[model samples]
Target: MPDEVRELAGVPVLVCDPDGPLVATEQDALDLIGAAFLGAQVVAVPANRLPEGFFSLGTRFAGDVMQKFVNYRLRLAVIGDISERLARSPALRALVHESNRADHVWFLPDLDALDARLRAAS
Candidate 1:
């Protein structure tokens, strides 16, 4: 991840999938978000496979990530199939919808669409 950041001549747009378990805490989420924002415009994390106990902590982390992005005015996009999340949490789904309505946070279905959105933003 560090190497990818260093290799970028300009801001990069990171594409990632949540293949492993979801993060456990706000700090961990922040760390990953920070890593992604390093020389990057967006970070795409998979929609499924989030931590089993992600309700409260995940919400907090999402809030933190939003604050960080607002503070720095950085852009980010979370891409993948979010049906699982929607099925589990209506609140989270609402949040995703609202975020996507904004200019910064986006919930897309695939990397290609994400890339298109980022390019459009730029």
Candidate 2:
């Protein structure tokens, strides 16, 4: 399935397909940002679509990608379970916790969680 835009809680969101291209580099993230520019106020990416390095804080992949979203004034929601990654790194756990507290970046467990968050915000 292709990535498409949908309205969640009255918010225009670009929901990426799980089988879509891997977001392994900054350029790849830029592609998503570009897509969001078309209409979406928020971008929802499946956790599986991201590479392992993205979950590693030391790699700075997550930070850089998230910074792009923030810089572009677009919200990003990483949807899907990251329990194993969080379990292995306290730093990642902290990052996820902090990101979730803000409106710009979110690490949600699923699409339903993203919907709920959007609804709450609305």
Candidate 3:
């Protein structure tokens, strides 16, 4: 499946494929704003499917991805378990914490948590 768009808490969201694009470069990140995510308020991407640089605080991939999304006024939810990666990088851990506290980008545990967050926000 390319991607599936579903409604959660009255919000349209596109749940990305687990085996889909590995967003390492700006081009990879920009691709999300294409046809698949049109009219979707949130786009969910699995942490495992993202490039390692996406989790690296010093890497441009993460910033570039977040910037593109913010510019387009799109919300992003990064789902899946990232405990190991978080453990290895304190900076990333801090960033995740900060992201969770914000409304734009979130590092949620899974799709269920994403649903809960959206529901709670409503």
lDDT: which candidate is best?
A: 2
lDDT per residue for candidate 2 within 1-122, as digits (tens), equals 89999999889999999999999999999999999998999999999999999998899999999999999999999999999999999999999999999999999998889999999988
What's the true lDDT of residue 87 in model 1?
Answer: 82
Candidate 3: count of backbone clashes, pairs at least 3 residues apart or interchain: 0
Candidate 1, residues 9-98, lDDT tens digits: the string is: 243765554565465566655665677665665655555534545433354766765566666666656657767767888888888788
lDDT per residue for candidate 3 within 3-104, as digits (tens), equals 788887888998888888686677776787774456788999888779888888786678788888889888999999999999999998888899899898
Error of 2 at 99 (Å): 0.5
Clashes of each: 0, 0, 0
Q: Candidate 3: where are CA atoms >4 Å away?
A: none
Error of 2 at 57 (Å): 0.5
TM-score of 2: 0.98
How many backbone clashes are present in model 1? 0
TM-score of each: 0.67, 0.98, 0.93
Candidate 1 accuracy as lDDT: 0.61
